[model samples]
Target: MQDVISKLVKVQELEMRATKVSASDAEVIKALRKGIPDPILAHYDRLRIRGKKGVAIIRNQVCTSCHMGVAIGTIVTLKQGKDIQLCGSCGRYLHLPPEPASETAVAMLPAKPKRKKRAAVRVPDAS
Candidate 1:
């Protein structure tokens, strides 16, 4: 799935770069389309009809195209790049770029600060 999306994005970039879609570009697209499942290809077609990008990068846990926050669990899966994941908000395909090891380590090192307990005060009897 990831491979298909990458190829599709590359095709899109090529199309954007050239004023007209060349024969080679069409062949690349055709080959890539052949490998993608019909359902997903249909979904991609629908998204294009709606004037939305078919592939969106997951940055800061947000869909770059839709500018919507993605679910934490979905982000986790995307980070691993094991399976194809869709944005919960706009249903656009999601991709996660590799992060540096230092950044990953820093992200994992932070622990939530504990809340301080409030001191209890005895109030004078107001009876």
Candidate 2:
């Protein structure tokens, strides 16, 4: 959540810098009000089981990242919004990026994560 807000502030700052928008105190307040809470998710459905460092991973029905089934207590915490939690698995970052603006904010944008693997894969496979 804090990360999302910080990113938004950076974006706003960049925009102001790019243009000559001298943000006023009132405008600043408005921008703060518009501060992003969940930059990737609009609603609370953004919760996802992602593995992270420190926590134990579950296997089988466990987390893909952690390889452990999330505990009941942790599950409760995830749904209840106690605090930022990580998966017991792979330690990769969890949570979804804030939901983009439905109609206007983003349009004709690619929905795929770009990768530099093409060049890497182009190399002949070492037998």
For this target, which candidate reaches the highest TM-score against the unseen true structure?
1
C-alpha positional error of residue 5 in candidate 1 after TM-score superposition, expressed in Å: 2.5
Give a tens-digit lDDT track for model 1, residues 10-127: 6556655666788988888788778888887788778877766777887776779877766666666555556778776677787776666655532343332322332235668889
| Backbone N/Cα/C clashes per model | 0, 22
Question: Could you tell me which 10 consecutive residues in candidate 2 have the lowest summed lDDT?
Answer: 43-52
Each prediction's Cα RMSD? Answer: 10.2, 15.3
TM-scores of the candidates in the order shown: 0.71, 0.26
lDDT of each: 0.68, 0.38
- Pick by lDDT: which candidate is best? 1
lDDT computed for candidate 1: 0.68
Residue pairs that clash (backbone atoms under 3 angstroms), model 1: none
TM-score of 2: 0.26
